[model samples]
Target: MNEMKEAVGNWREAKQFSPADENDFLRWLDKADTEEKLFSRLTFWFTFRGLPADQNQRYHLVQERARELRLWNGLELKLRRWQDRVADEYEQIGKEAFAARIGEDYADYINSLTDPEAAPQQAAPEPETAKPAGVQAWSARELSEMVLPPIRHVVEGLLPMGMGVLVAKPKLGKSWMVLDLCLAVAQGEPFLGFPTQQHGTLYLALEDGKSRMQTRLRRLLEGRPAPANMHVMFQAQRLGEGLLEMLGEYLDANPDIHLVCIDTLSKIKPKAKPFENAYDADYDYMGRLKAFADSRGICVLLVHHTRKSKNPEDSFDNINGSTGILGAADFTIVLDKQSRMDDEAGFLLTGRDIEQCERVIRFDKARCRWVMQGTAAQLAAQRRVAEYEAEPIVKTLRVLLQQGDGTWSGYSKNLMEMGQRYAHTELAPNLQMLSKRIQELQPMLWERDTIRYWYNSNGNAGRKHNFRQERADNNASVPVSAQLSLRHNYH
Candidate 1:
């Protein structure tokens, strides 16, 4: 009951500006001296229940105030700001009202609001048609008819326009990764072997000092001219205080900007209210950022850290927050490094607009940039081939196959003895070991040498092995020893 009374009291206080007269509102605006204060007051005015109910009147008053403050140029933006605030207010009010309605008579509550005789001081509101609210759905036909633009990527086909989180452990070159990305986008250069769409970029390097940032920038630039379209800031306001406003103003001034990177999400994350669910808070915070970026057709990359304990099975689980953080983002990239001393790292990318892929990248110490090696699958294939070719047992089998004119058949024991006698290479310690080694090399042998191997176990006799070339190849004429040397050098 006390909560309901407080809500009514607040509603009445908010109604002070809802009247037709502009004199009192103008007087109130006069007190907001600074630009931030002006924006804050305008936000507060639009958020409460009792601003002019007529949309046009509300806009007119806001326009007049903006014009007086030399903010007339952003009238449309201010209107959007108003709409967003009203939507938020509606949601919050609905939640509170739902909680207040428990054990209360709904018809009595409606009667109290509608009964002008009971409250003589309040004038009756004019009746207006109820508008649709709450969740909305679209039919397939409606969706099909809409011609939405393709998702534009900052790094073409990799980083699309929307909010994304890039998570890595501390001191793992995550900052350098984003810094390089910003430079590439600003200069229209390729990033990590992928083509980029050039445009303006902003890097909020809140944790780094000017000197450190300068040093890193110089290292990356390599004496090249600095990008004029790239902007950096060492400080920023926290979210809900003035951060969104600050970013929006900058974006408004620079219409070409397609990417904004916030170094360390902790710098601008809003504090949670008492008893708030962590997931709800995280989702709401990130959703606001995603909405802002999506509306402008730009990408906001949030640099963040992973948890101390890693989740080997799922890289997304290592992100340093509730699932809501990743759930709200349009995409996520997790950087994993096997060792602090290793130069190579794995980037696991998954999102709505990009395919799930793992890219192998190596840090270039000279330029302080990450160089793309290839996809993880490609690297793994190459590693397997190298390991296969270097095996002594593989060399013996290759020589035997070459001398036998690409055909050899025998039991595991016979093949092992032949390897020791002719090729002078121990195939394996025993018959069972030799059979296991042959099985392990089966795939590599077929792929590299076209030699197919199969076991022929006669029921009454014994198990025998058969090896034959799938087809004739040019490597048949090349000496086996010479081929081995050439393959080693090639790798």
Candidate 2:
């Protein structure tokens, strides 16, 4: 041990030696033939025993001495070249084996403190497993199977996990609808068109008045008791904060929360250009929310509005803002009025990965609820009605006219033929109905006409009675007898 300590001190002193001396020491090591001779010479030069039970400690000391001597040599051409060669040889000796001697941790600790102010002292990092170069370059399989969260179909099953949307035009019972769903879900009752299973929920509504929300909830629940697990948050104005920063605190406190509802996304997102540029503010905000959901495995339902140019035929394409909003959503639904005065409204289910069926739900304003519009058989009947309504009579007439070479003179005959063709054995009744319907639709048909009309007469003696421009000479009157005579001759 004393010899080892002396060798360590000499090694530190050797770091200050000139390049010529370092060269002389290397030459002496090369000349030594036996291990004992080599050890004795190294000890004499370093002024310490060069051997330790651990080969790593011995090699580390030798490398350290080499580095110090090279630095002491300071910019000499031959010395610099020699230092590079020494470093290559040192690295080739297997750092892991050397590292294992004092344990990699202690080796790193000693290395770090050599220049304490220059580099931060840190815990030694665990050795990373070496991946093959081929693996690094290889692409993942395109058809790799993905694991997705299970979907709950029933309202009872959905309510517990968080699912549903309340939608309507402004001031047309949107809030009221949401309140109703919340009350139903909280009480484990049947919710608009579906039965809800009970689960702990978090309701966060920023826009609603406290009193109004409470009153509406009371109306929705009527006499039912509220669930103790149901929680309400009147304010959630800052949801975009880092997941671990904002929600981490809340989730730590309330681990039981399963369903989370943010009444409107507009209130939560800070005023930014989510609409103009999707990748900027919109992506960042949604990314944070999605990460939060994934980490917690909680269902987050966000209520939003339809675009001003919303098409009744399509629902998902009509949602407002960067398509990213809807693109990120797992499910999307739209509520719309079928007519201006119709009390019954419809909800169009647009995007749901699970169901192939398109559902049409009717809103019962009196009960403030949604109910499935028709039974299976009733649905078939309604489909027939819809088919009949959509079968365009005018379009059929236009097609007939086209087939008749675009002449109104042959229009009636062509119409009769078409009626006969379509009516099969009921031709006469069909023709009669067609003629009546056409007569009833004449004004509309004439308005759609693309032709002009005029009248002409040959200058025969019988046709050469009299002519007058009545409007041109209203006050330039001729005798009443003459005018009567002229009218009679013209006729």
Candidate 3:
């Protein structure tokens, strides 16, 4: 394969923002104090290059592409910022004026340069073709009436009605974690801090027999009534061994089941045929599983492994197989250990329709469940220092935001006041500490007016903490799962 080129052109090519101040660019773009101003800044992105003729090419679509590119903050905003610095007379005239005058000529230059931020456009159009099988266009009202994916919080954003994977190195207790998930869904109990929806859950213990599974369950249930809804299969037939048929028939029998877990990928992995491609085999297996999940609106959790050199920065990079398997799945959840021995660990959750998260966890031998220990910062990563250090304060605000209509608006002073009330301080913290905490939780926090706002993506947190309520702290136990706000920052 040829080495991939940058979207614009080259790295050292003509540019607006210097590489020296990229961090400053991100911080500046995100520093808006109000929602109106933030949206205004957002508008600048489209205005610079005329908004896309196709609606899908507009702000949201391009922004999604930026995330895929890992541009840090808002993609268009960053691009616009760069343009402001680089475009001739950008500061003297204005972005709209400069962009209109330059347009594709600028792209022509970038085509010759190395700008990774550049978005490539096709010169020649492909012939129009009929939509693929079962793919139908949606009418406006049909789309409006259709349930979009975010009616969420099945285990509070970890499990949903599409494909997802849970990965960890061997002996990191991934099985215990997933077994806890299945057991939680089966019994309508909480998984970690998140509430379970009480559904029949299938656990394909492909790597373990019934006896071992029984032992694990006893440890999890700990004398509580075993959820009859929980179903277990000691071993699974290989992919071509009627696995799909058997699983489909089982779902047919138990229509209420919405979750199926495969303990480890290797067990049920089909043997490769002569001349078969490894990537194809991996992707094909996952596609079959994903199809089953999507067809029935069920959740499938595939337990897999991470390679030795796990990328703490991006969990997807550490997955042990071809990129095709990742392409086939909806998202991934990766668990990693600081050391091979029983030590501190963290799990990174990233995928389509799931809010990205990485958090510290400790396994409790007595309860046989992972406890929310802290943020991944405890594992000693230096990036995103604020999120790492002020995780508790950020989570408190997350709970507060979710208690109301999943949003809040307040001046910095008001926010600090609220933070002080919720802060689990042994000695009352200063305004600076509280203010610093709010500032650090930026990805989850937004500004709209003179007021700053934030929300929980799962949609069911912090309603009781409405800023308009003139609310008192109610003196609760720090918003744990048992306390309220399952989606609150457990880390």
Candidate 4:
């Protein structure tokens, strides 16, 4: 293969090709170790030459090679992806023309290829009998009027019955969570306060030994007996090697199976080729699993890890791999924590079938299971209130207000001195940070603690702040006008 690549490179550099070069390429293709490798090299060469025109000599050479190798499925996969990516542009060029270039027979078979993302077209309903097969088109009105079954969920309102990725930092209880999910589904139990459908489940514990899994299971079960329907495997073949076929056989043997969990995606995924685009590699690998799951109408949850650096704007961006993984999935669940030491973590869920949700879950160390705390917004507000009560500056302000007549008006410098004298910890690094913190906490303070803070900067005298405590009974909510003026006055 290396020699073949060098030969192709020389021909490309010289901008010339002869019968001898063509013979050498054909011979190398025959010597290729596997069909997948041959396909990879061919596509790399094709793409390197800028996806040659249909009439070009190189394009014909590739088509002939693909035909001789019987790489119709590979060609079809590429065409589908290209058609999907380029959409209207591909329609303009014609899908049949592209498939026919590979081979005429493949063009006929292309329509039969299952696209998980594409809706199946059906003919108009008959007067009595069901619509006959081979009806490929549907008008917009027909599509809109067609009644489809609702998407099923393995875990109600959280996980839909399709392929999904569960991502979190390593050692953040992802394995534990999925293990619990398997048991819950197998036994028809509620998981994290949500009801789960009872079904057979397969857990691919590729990274853990039986002993470790047993220990975790025992811990989770406590006095209860383990469910008989949940099966676990310690090792498996890589995806292309035999993983899918093995799973198919397993499903056939256990016809009741509805959930298959892979501990870590990296373990079973095939090794990527050097020439393959990172995004394309992820999409292709995940797309295969997605197709298999959708066809079986089961839930396949892939356990994955998040990137070290966080994306403040988007939680999904923190997923370790390229966007293709999320792009190919039906849904994605990300588990995030502000700190590993904290017992509570945010569980984010988003997908096509389910509405987006964010929940706060706390790890119950005793049972080795996550307990639902509440909605994310509620928990966040509670945390803020707790923080405000314990904050040194707030404590210092309370003491000063109590020592005085429940009102303090002074410059930030004076407040800093008073805070240091009265408070045990430093209020902040400097007067600037102290002022900012006070303003940042204004809403919480005013709304929760009946403390109204007003600060303004004077030209040469520096910033002056006025803090007054309102009667607890009189405090209801911060006025809209005051909330709007909070930042302005602080600035």
Candidate 2 C-alpha lDDT tens digits along 341-363: 66545555534443423445565
Off by over 4 Å in 2: 1-168, 241-248, 273-276, 374-491
Candidate 1 residue pairs in clash (backbone atoms < 3 Å): none
- lDDT by residue (1-491, candidate 4, tens digit) is 22322333332321222112233344433333334444433533342222122114444444444544456456756744643554464367554433222222111122224333332333344454333353334556645654434667889998897899999999999999999999999999999999998888999998999899989999998879999889999999998999998997787567577899999999998898879898999999999999888756688999999998899888899999899999999999999898999899999999989999889899999888999999978987888889988888888888877776677788988888888798866888988898889878888777876788876668899988877778754454555655556666556
Error of 1 at 371 (Å): 3.4
By TM-score, the candidates rank as 1, 4, 3, 2
Model 2 / residue 208 / CA error / Å: 0.9
For model 1, the run of ten residues with the poorest summed lDDT = 101-110
**What global local distance difference test value does model 3 have?**
0.59
What lDDT score belongs to each candidate, Candidate 1 first? 0.73, 0.48, 0.59, 0.73
RMSD of 1: 15.4
Candidate 1, residues 1-491, lDDT tens digits: the string is 34434443333333322321233344444433334445444544444313132223445545554554455676667667756775666577664453233212222232344564532232222234122332234456645754444556889878988899999999999999999999999999999989998888999999899999999999999999999999999999988999988987787567677799999999999987899999999999999888788656578999999999988899889999899999999999998988888999998899988988899999999889999999988999989989887877777777788888777878877887887876688878877888778877877787898776666666755667777775645344534643453354334
Q: Score residue 77 of candidate 2 by CA lDDT.
A: 54
lDDT per residue (tens digit) for residues 109-178 in model 3: 3343455344334223223422343344544654565433343445866666688888888878888988
Model 1 vs. true fold: TM: 0.62
Local lDDT at 357 for model 1: 85
